[model samples]
Target: MNTETFINQNWHDANQQYLSAALAVVRGALESYTTSLPHPPELTAQAAARQQAVQQAAAAMPAPSALENLCRLFELSGFERDLLLLCAGMELNGDFARLCAIAQGDAQKAYPTLSLALAALAYPHWDAIAPNAALRRWRLIQVGEAHTLTLSPLRLDERILHYLVGIQYLDERLAGIIEPVPQLGELVPSHAALAQKVTAVWNQTKTTTLPIVQLCGNESSSKRAIASQICQIQKMHLWVMPAQVIPLLPSELDNLIRLWTRETILSKSALIIDCDELDINDAARLNAIAHFIERTNGYIFINSRERMRLPQRLLVSFDIQQPTAKEQSAVWQAALSDIAPQLNGQVKILVEQFNLSPATIHAACAEAAGQLAQSQNNNLTDILWDACRIQARPRLDELAQWIEPVANWEDLVLPETQKQILRDIAAHVRQRSTVYNTWGFAGKSARGLGISALFAGASGTGKTLAAEVLANQLRLDLYRIDLSSVVSKYIGETEKNLRRVFDAAEQGGVILLFDEADALFGKRSEVKDARDRYANIEVSYLLQRMESYPGLALLTTNLKSAIDTAFLRRIRFVVQFPFPDAAQRAEIWRRIFPPNTPIADLDVVKLARLNVAGGNIRNIALNAAFLAADAGEAVQMKHVLRAAQTEYSKLEKPLTEAEIGNWS
Candidate 1:
C-alpha cells in the first residue's frame, strides 16, 4: 500500500482499539452500578484484556496513536484520559448515552460527569476537576453548569473530538484570526539556507526554550516563504496572525495567548506574527503583541519590516533580502526553460532591470506564457517586461506619482553636453551589473557605486522633461516624488517615508525624480536644538540611501547652492540646466507647435524676443493656440502678443515693450 493508505489503515485500527477500551470501561462501570456491588470476575478480566489490547495496538502502530499522542502531549493521567474518551464516545458512538444513563441510575442524567467517573473508574483523583487541570486548562473538555464539580456534565471539544477520529483541522475558534500558510514549491538557494539555519536553531533549542525568531526584512513575501519552509522542515503547521488584530485588553490578550498555546500543543503548529502592517507608533498594540509573545510557549516568528525591540524576551533575528542577481538569473532560466534558448540574451537584461524574487519571476513568466498562448505574434520579451512593471506598480503607486514617460530626446531642449550626460547616466545603469558583478569593481569596494545625478537650474528649464526623456530612453518607469510631501516636521517620520519610497522602487529599478529637493536637502545648520540635530541626521540618511540605491535616483533643485557640500561631493554627475538664451528660445518656439495646428503667418524672430524659458514659451504657445481656436482664425502675431501679456501678468512682471515690441 501507499504511505497514505497505510497511515489511514493504521489510524483506523488504533481508533478501534481505543474505542474498545472505552466501551469496556463503560460496561464495567454499568455492570457494577446495576448489580449494586463490585464488578464480576469475568467482567473485570474483560476490562483488563481491553486495556492490554489498547496498549499492544498502540505499540504496534507505525505512528503514535492520536489519542495516545494527545494524552502524552498534554501530560494527562489515566483517569483524565478515560474521561476524555468517555466524552468523545458520547459524540462518536450512539450507545454511550444509554450506558451513561445505566451507570448514573437516572435516565435524565445521561451525560458523563466527574461524580460518575470517580465512583466507577479506577484510580480517579478529585484534583482532575480543578481549574488548572489538564482538561480545564487546555479546554479539551468542557464542563457544563452544575452546583457541584462532581455533577458537572462533560463534553469533548469539537476540534479534539475530530482529531481523535483521525480528522485533523484547525480549531473553529481560531479560524477567524489565523490562516494556514501554504508551503512553497521550490526555494531559492538563499531562502533555502535561511530555512536550514532556522531548522538548526529550532533543533538545538528543542531541549531548552525556543527563542522567538524575528524575521527583519523589507520583503514580506520572502520572509513568509522562509517561515513556511522552516515550519515544514520541522514538521509543524504554520499559521499566520496579524499583529494589529491582537487584543489590547489584558484579559482578552491573556485568553488569546492561552488558547493559541493550547492549540499549538494539540496541533503541532507554529505562529508567525505578521507585523508588516503594524504601526510602530501604536504603543498599546505593540505592548499587547509583546505580552502575547512573552507568555506563549511554542515556536513563534515575528515578521516586521525593521527589527523591533522586545526587552521582555530573547529573540533570534534573520535578515532576508531578495535573491541575488545570479540567483535571479537561475530562477528566470528555470521558470522559462522552454523559451530560454530563444531568449537567452535577454534574461540578464530582465534580471538586471527588475530585481524580482523567484516567486514574482515565475509569476511574470506564467503571465507571459498566458499572453503568448492567446496571441502567437506577441513579443515574449516585451510581455515579460510589462508584466514585471505591473508586478512592481502597486506599491510604488501608493507612495508616489507614476508619470508616463512620453518625452524623448528630440522633445528635450537641453544643451548637447547636458544631453550627453543624461545619455551616459542611462548607459551606466544598463552596464552596472556587467562592470560590478562580471568585472571586479564590486569586489574592490561598494562605496558610491549607485548612479545618482542632480539636475540643478531655474524652473521651466526642462529638468522634469529631461527626467522623462531618460526614463523613456531606458524603457523604465519614472516616479516623481515631491519632497514637500515626503519631508515631515515629526522626528523620524521623514526617514520612514523615504525608506518606503526606496524599498518599493528597488525591485523594479524605477527612476526616481525627487522634485524641489532643496526643501529637504538643504545645507546642514549648527546644532542649535534637537530639531537641528535630527535635521542633519535626516540629510545624512538620505545621502547614505542615495549612495547605496541600486537604481537611478535623480534629484532636481532650483537652488543648487542650497544643497549640502557633502551631498554634492557624492553625486556622480551634476548637470546644470541654464536659462535658455535667445537662440535656444527661438529653437524651442520653432518645434513647440505640432504639425496638426493651423498657423497664420507668425514671425519666430519676434516671438523669440520674449525673455522666457522653454517652459513659459510652450505655455504661451498653447494659450495662443487656444485663443486663436476661439477666435476662428489660425494663430497669428496678435494672438501670441495677447498670450504674452497674460503670461507676464501671471508672473507678476510688467509687460515691457523691450521684449515684445513690434510683435504686433
Candidate 2:
C-alpha cells in the first residue's frame, strides 16, 4: 500500500479504538452511579483504567482525532468536553438511555441532561451549560426545551455529531446561502501578481487580526480569480455568499454570524461577500451587511464594483483592473494556442478593440473554434472578430436600444464634405490601434483617445442616418440613447446613469449614439446654485468618459450653437448634417425605393421639388409603396403626391402648388 493509504488506515483504526474506549468509560460511569451498591472500589478502579486507555488510544493516532480538534477549536474545558460526550453518548449508544433513567431515579427521564451530567460525570461545572459557554456558543450541544436549565434535555447537534466521527462537509444550515469558488487555472501575469500581493499583505501584517481585503473593480470575474488564487496559495477553500442574502432579522443574522464563524474553523475556508449587484438604495440590507462584516470573524474578501466604506475594520483596498494590453495579447495567444501561428496580427487587433477579461476571451475563443470546426473554408480572423463582438454585446443591450445599422454610404444623402467626415470617423475607429499603440500616441497619454463626434442639424436632416452609416461602415452595433431622457433632474442621478452607460460600453463592439444632447450638453451657464455646479460636474464626468472610451461615441443635437464650445473642442469630429438640396433630395428619391418594388414612370425631378429632407423623402417613398400595394397597382405619380401630402401634414407645413405643380 502507498504511504498515504497506510497512514490513513492506521489513523482510522486508532480513532475507532479511541471512540470505543471513551464510550465504554461513559457507560461504566453511568452504571456505577446507578447501582444499589454504589461504592464498589473495583468498578471505580476499572472505570479509571478505561479512561487512561481512552487517552492512550487518542495519543496513538497519527493525526489529531476529530474530537480532539473540536475541543481545541472551541476551547472546550474539561467539564464542557465531558458534558458534550454525555450528550453524544445518548445518540451514539442505546444503553446510555437506560443508564440515564436508572441513575436519575425516574423512568420518565430517559435522556441525558445537564442535571444528569452533573450527577454522573467527573469534573462537572454549572458554567459548562451556560449560554455563552463553548458547548452552547459553538452549538456543539443543543439544550432541549424544559422547565429548568439543569434539567433541560441536552442533545448533540446533528452537524457536530457527524463532525465528531471525522466526517467533513459544509454545514447543512448554510448550504443554501453559500457556494464554493474554485481557483481558476492559469491567471494572467498581472492577476497573478495581484494574487502574490494579496498573499504578502495577509502574511506580512503583524496585527492581531487579519485585515479584510476589498477588491474594487468592474470586472467581477477577475476579482474572483484573484481571491480564489489567494485561497489556493494559503491552502484554504473559498466560498461566495451574495450580500443580498444577509438576513434582515437581528436574531437570524446573529445566528448566521456564529454559525459561519464556526464553519470557517471547521472547514478551513474563507468567504467572499459578493456585493457587485447590490442596490445601493437598500438601507436595511446595507446595514445588515455592515453588521455581518464587523462581527463575523475569519478571512474575508469583499467583491464589489466600487470600494465599500466598512468602518471599524482594517480594510486593505485594491483596485482590480482587467488584464493589460500586453497581458491580453498573451492570453489570446494562449487561448488560441493551436491557431496562434495562423493569426498573424489579428491578436493585436482584437486586444486593441475589445477590453475583455481572460475568462471572456477564452469563452469567445471557444465559440470561434466551434464555428471554425464547422466550415474549414471560412476566414479564421473574421470568425474570431465576430465571436468577440458577440461576446461583448450583452452589457450594452440592457442600457440602450440596439439599432441594427442598414444605412450604408450609398443610402445617406449628405453633402460630400459631411460624408467624408463620417468616413474619417470610421477610419479612426479602424486604425486607432496602429496610430495609438504602434505610433506611441497611447503611451504619451490616454486622454482624448476615444473617437467622439457631434452631428448637428435640424430635425430629419439625417443626423441619425449619418450615425447609422458610420456604424455600418465600421461593422459595429449602434445603440441610440436619448440624452434628454437620460438627463435626470435629481442631483447626481444623471451622472450615475451616464456612468452605467460608459462602463457597460467599455468593451468596444458598439457605437454609443446620444441623440438630442442639446439640453444636457449645452453651454455652461454661470454657477449660481448647487444645481448648476452639479450640472457642470455632470458634463465634466461625461467628457472624461468620452475621452477614455475605447470605441466611437456620437452625440446629435438640433442646434450646433447650443453645444458648449469647451465640449465641442474636446470632440474629435463635428459633422454638420445640412438639409438636402434639390439635387441631393432627388438622389435620395432615386435610391429610396428597393429594387424589388414596382414603379410606373416615377419622376425624381418632380419628387425632389417637394421641400423635405432625406428622412421625410424616405417616409414618403415608404408610404407611397404601401399605398400602391393596397391599391393593387405600381407606385405612380398620384401615389407619390398623396404620400407627400400626408408627410407635409405631419410636418405641419403647407404643400405649395409651386413645389408639386409638375407631380401630376
Best candidate, TM-score-wise?
Answer: 2
Clashes of each: 0, 0
For residue 570, model 2's alpha carbon misses the true position, in angstroms, by 0.9
> TM-score of each candidate?
0.91, 0.93
Candidate 1 accuracy as lDDT: 0.85
Residue-wise C-alpha lDDT for candidate 2, range 1-664, written one tens digit per residue: 9999899888878877877787788788788778777577888799889989998998898898888888898898877777777777888888888888999989999999888888888888888888888888888888889889888888899888888777778888998898889779778888899899999999998976788999988888889999999999999999999998989999999999989999988878999999988877689988998899889768999998777887788899999988899999998988898855677788987888899999889889999889988977578778888888888874644457888889888888887898888888888999998999899999999798988999999888899988888888777888998565578988988887888788777877889999988888898879999999999999999999999988999999999999999999999999888888899889989999999999999999988898898889889999999999999999999999999999999999999998988666
In the predicted model 1, the residue pairs found to clash are none
Q: How high is the lDDT of residue 350 in model 2?
A: 88
The lDDT values for all models are 0.85, 0.87
**Model 1 off-target regions past 4 Å?**
20-24, 27-31, 34-62, 98-109, 146-151, 375-378, 593-610, 618-649, 656-664
Deviation of model 1 at 79, angstroms: 1.7
Q: List the residue pairs that clash in candidate 2.
A: none
lDDT of 1 at 565: 92
Model 2, residue 528: C-alpha shift (Å):
1.3
The positional error of residue 98 in candidate 1, measured at the CA in angstroms, is 4.6
